[model samples]
Target chain A: MKGGLFTSGYGPILIVVVALAVLPFGFSANTTLNFLGFVLIVTLAAQGWNLLAGYGGQFSFGHAAFFGMGAYGIALAQVRFGLNPWLALPLAIALGALTGTILGYLSFRARLRGSYFALVTLAFAEVFRILANASTFTGGAAGVLIPLRIDAANFQFADKRSFYWLALSFVAFVLLLTHWIARSRFGAYLVAVRENEDAARALGVDALAVKLKAITLSGGITAAAGCLYAQKFLYIDANLAFGPWISVEALLAPIIGGIGTVFGPLAGAVLLLGLGEITKTFFTWLLGGAVPGIDLVVFGVLLILCVAFAPRGVLGVLRRILPAFRGGRA
Target chain B: MGVRARAILSHGSMMLKFDIFLSALANGLLTGAVYALIALGLTLIYGVLHIINFAHGATLTLAMFAVFVAHQAFGLDPYIAVFILTPLFFVLGYALQRAVITPASHGDDGNILLVTLGISIIIENALLAIFRSDTRSIDVPYGFSVMEVGPLFLSTPKVIAFVATLAVAGLLWLLLARSDTGKAIRAVAKEKTGAALCGIDVAHIYAVTFGIGTACLAIAACLLMPTFLVNPRVGNAFVLVAFTIVVLGGMGSIGGALAGGLIIGVVESLSGLYFGESLGQIGIFLIFLVVLLFRPTGLFGAKA
Candidate 1:
């Protein structure tokens, strides 16, 4: 059963990965590559959000806290401690997991859930943002800048394609991990807890333990995306790292794609970013200038429309329209 | 200097410090009055609808912008604008809940959260698109006037805000306690299915509650215009603190919110005095976290 579980999803997973991997070859334009890389990084963060929210039913409004920790972790390690970028990446990811563990422990220990939990997470993010902004350890408000050196050894690639490939590989790894979790017993336990915590606890499941593990895993994956962001941008600031925008994007992707599905984040990320591009371009043309906030306004409308029309997401819409397209949930 | 002289100097300084503390407390109370007003709307909506209106801040921002536009374009006094904007905003809020949020959310908690969030994003950005990102504040005639009482000087606008807030709260309390609509809202809040079974229009009540809450913001904006600056993101500062106040005051308790806002305001002021302005913001979040963790019901709230 274990072997079959592991093997069954690999075919579709491999096909998706291979298709994404070869996309740079078809459209090697820097703009296209950059867009894809950004989308893939966002997909990683969304996947992290999906793990806890979609599967575990623990909705965090502050995934940015973990994402920012990863970003600051990488930046501080490289710039402040003089650690190698490659070593910094793993440490950064670990730092995010630790943050998640600490926050999850405190919040869950108090039995806070639902909107209370969501608000608390948001408060935590705000606290972190304020601290990071005020402390000299984070270079105050001026922010930290990693000295750029274009080299494969330093994890800084010369070509956009290399960075795109790196991002794709990380996303692919997380996708597989998600696929595994979807099939594993652990996943079943998580779903059970999400469906009804009291019932699951009655059936001998340690709901707290399952939640803690889910948050920890979620944090680490999101931090990896943050780590990648720092590597890509070579800069870090309090707002950029711990902002509500990243948190919004993280949740928006999984929600728009299809919550609880492995590829939902990926599909949602692609569609969201594509929609963003379309809105920006269209709005710019309509307004006769580049204006801020229009894309986000459109996103807000889309979010409401999605909730109203397609509560299950784009995947759900597709399933409804194409009844025979049921290939066993993405 | 002699020992007696030195001791006298120290005593004088201690007296001065006490005076400073008193003033800070007074200032906190005045600022908190406005905060309570902002949070009143939030608590009302939450009590009835059970959804955290993420767009609360944006609506506040929009109202502030309305006040600004009315003043800039029509040369209207903010005090006068309040009467006009409040009713207008009530209608806006009603339509928003009835036409947009209620229909969009479909009564799911998660969907409601997303829809509100989406509404916030749209409203905030729409303001940004129209007003640009620059902070704007009106120069009212009484902007810098001060009221002095027992070694404390309070800004005239803030003092007025405090008095007006109390009046609004009293009015709201009366409305909730006396009116049939208020009884329906209270009934709906306590038991939605029961209220529905009793032939009360739950949707209309929900929209009415939302409208009342948003109307509170219009009043808050008018009161705040003379003293506070309005930017695209300015409402965020109040929104977070308002949430903290709502939780601290007890989720649905009107009196608790008022008291909580005042307490949080004083705490913020004292923290800012010692910890510097930027770091002082942490005090609010800390209180928020603590209240949420330890006393989710708040002081005046009935146990869930």
Candidate 2:
């Protein structure tokens, strides 16, 4: 907010934003938009993880709990309470933040750190999954389905491009928020906490406050993605909402792209999900039968290579190679 | 009270309920003993490497599949497959440590977690590619034999699994306490620099320690084959409980892992009976959360 909108810090972002805005006109079928929409939504979730794990110094292994909360929040709202989907968006994200607050409050208040925090978050997600599977309010394991009334008020769209544009807007909002937060005073405090908690506390940083805020924001963002996911699929289930695979997907993108950077999750989600689809299609064509989760193996190998060869990530490697691009604070 | 909560409270009020509780207890102990073996290896690996190997679950699953494949393809008994797989896995672990894990062990904890997790994904998916996703089970002739204990009956597979686990644990204990290589591994885990000063091959020891850790899973795989089915993702069912046991028993304590295993076993059994099968995970997680928050060092952790 302090700097000019087209400052050096946002050169690449401006290009991407302009391109995405004009992208729909180039393609008539909405195929590219739908694919990119999926990428953007997942990128949104990945950014949330980047904020918490990469910047906030809290590694949450259960972000799916909030993603699920967002999904279930909207599904339950529309199905159980007969609320409009438009009215449900904010509530879903709020529910996500609320979930984050609970997870953060319990773990952070206990002063749990590192693996302890990770494990607790994982446990929390597991519990949520079980509850979703068991509780009638959640429709049990059968999951909740949205009513097939495609009204604009209900956030349903006649054209796939409308949903794509909406998803793009959400992605842009998160990217801008993350850009501002990455340079804010609180963001500095978060970086300090992540670099060294004891040292950060010694330097008068409120470690707990920073972590709580980061986690809350992270949860809300992830939940927002869940809402979009539900909208795109028009259905929600326990596995889709609260599965470990969701958590893994959210985290994997940011880690592979360039953690802690605003564009990292965006690039990562594209690379991972985009590449995954391409490879799956190619392999499926080559072998004539689906290789049964071949994409996971490829992605797994990529993850291993990234950690081993580029532990700092593709952005980190790029920054190292181009000193002029290096803008302080990893 | 909620139906689930009430079910939890009334685990054993009637004759049938009492009988069920007793049977669950028996089942828990037998499974818990085997769980002890799994936890022991995990704890030992973490103790030495100072890294929680995320690929361990995948490795366990791979070992289980090895036995399953050997049995299905060649008609070898599960117990006999143990002799073949144990050494095979050790070599694999050793090679993996030297080639893959060692390079990534550059002081950053997150890298290890991700790399091992990546390995786990690779292993799981590779298995899925090969075997499809269908569950595979082995048939043992004596697997169903039940022994009478007054009014209680214990199945042969469970008893054999329990005895085998205890025997393995006793052997591991003696090895760690008495053998020179085992002591060297312990010394390295306790004090890496000090062990190096005493002329210990640090890297070699690390690799061997990893091998031993993986070898333990081989035993677990074979022993578990009689009672459980194997699938690409079967390791997930047991891995979380194994992790909880490792944390509960203190990071590297053998006795603590054993105790933790038994506790989890009972918890799983009782919770499964009380709360329909799926909700039992909630109980395990709650216990893990409590243990984590209250005592970060764990029950049997050495005083820091």
Candidate 3:
């Protein structure tokens, strides 16, 4: 509660934030915009997860459920019912919260903690994946394809810059909210619960309510990321929407970048996804032909190495390299 | 399914429903045996280490692929393959516990989970790179045959899986309940500090337990080769089953695993009739969530 509004001491982060906002203007190149969009959209989901796992102390293995819901919420709204994608965005996010509320309530009330709690979420996501695959409305295995109309209301744009801006704005909003949560009184209660639920409850923390609230907020943010993903790809499939890989990425970003850090998720996303692309291209060229997911193997090795060597993440490493870059607690 | 059936249908219909139930029960028992073996391996590791081996399913997947390769190269039958790979997987599991899991285990619960998750990612993606994601299966001689016993039908491979599952579980139970090393392992699982105080080699027990767990997977993998297709993503499929069984059976309980596996197997088989294939998996996961929330210690778990 004693921390400032920004984790980067406000000044450096301010410049970074400003640069990110105006980035598309100067560097509207497709590659830059594409990469930014991916990172920013993924950042939304990763930050949500970071808030929950890093701060709230709930290690969820099922964030893909909310991500899938967000993707389906917007996809089904616009394609199945002809609703505007813009209008559907909030609906998607709300649905994410609703799903989170239900699962969170059940799990918290039943006293599911640690890996069991995580497994429950994973099971829910798996269930959703199968339901999506079996249903006729989701287009079954082939997936739902949005009309290629270049309309603002549809959230489709001819230039990738608009997509980048939309993603940046969403990520910025979530980051600020997370910033507030991290410094607020409620945020303290969250950390307390994460550190020791029984003791937190002994001090009258209302453990169930605190956990549920964190999960709901996290779910809503992740769902919005899902919607962004759907809009960017213009395709929604069972696998793409509810795949375990999405959940893995959501957790991996924060863990690798710096779990519980405000900028960790963003940093992790950039490092993992960004490095993933570079290594993939480099390895593919070296080996000749598509190496077929060697980059993922690299990622796995990297994750293990990071966990073993730098449990605190990249921000932790940065802090070690330059002691001046330290303040917030993880 | 309802008493209304008595009023609206003939005795023949009632008998037919009974027959269907019996058939499902038989099939469930057979399938549940295999599920028990797989889930038991997961539970054993968790019991001793207090860490969720997210990569357990991936290791099982690795064993399945090993069977596939053994078949392709040497034409080794899955039955014989199980015996051959058991020692090999035991060594692999032992080395992994020593090198990767041991360090991460001391870090934190999340670290261990994430580390295993990383291992899974590496194993799965490596398989994808090498195998190209095509589904592979073992063609056993009696792979598809079914035996009928008083209106109950059982698949041949499934029966073999059931028999082999029981044998392995029994052998493991004996080792844990009777042997000195098994007592050492149980003591470590129950109280790591106390076990160490008693001069037990806790780290060595951890490795041995992990080894036995992976050895169990080797057996289950070969048993499943004739029934299920092997793919890089097969871990995703079976991990859910193992999670459900482990939760329902109570982690670290051998008999409970068999019982829980049977229950889930029956539920899945019966539900498959109504929900079809993929939805059947959804049903299993739903049960998993329910058990996880309502009874996190599982039915047989008594706060151990």
**Which prediction has the highest DockQ against the true structure?**
1
| Tens digit of per-residue lDDT, candidate 1, span B1-304 | 9543453466577777886788788888899889999999999999899889989999999999999999999999999999999999999999999999988888889788889889998999988887889988998899988876755667889999999999999999999999999899999999999999999999999999999999999999999999989999998899999999999998877888899889888888888888888867988988888888888888666543
Model 1 - which docking category?
A: medium
Alpha-carbon local distance difference test for all models: 0.90, 0.84, 0.87
> How far is A279's C-alpha from truth in model 1 (Å)?
1.4
lDDT of 2 by residue, A250-317 (tens): 88888888878888888789889988898889988998988887889988898888887776677788
Off by over 4 Å in 3: A1-8, A327-330, B1-21, B146-153
Provide the TM-score for each candidate, comma-separated.
Answer: 0.96, 0.94, 0.94
Candidate 1, residues A74-165: lDDT per residue as tens digits?
99998889999899999999999999999999899989888888888889998999999989999889988989999998989999989998
Q: Per-chain TM-score of chain B, candidate 1?
A: 0.94
Clashing pairs in 3: none
Candidate 1 collision pairs = none
lDDT of 1 at B160: 93
Q: Candidate order by lDDT, highest to lowest? A: 1, 3, 2
Best by the TM-score measure:
1
Model 1, TM vs. native: 0.96
- Please tell me which predicted candidate would have the highest lDDT against the true structure: 1
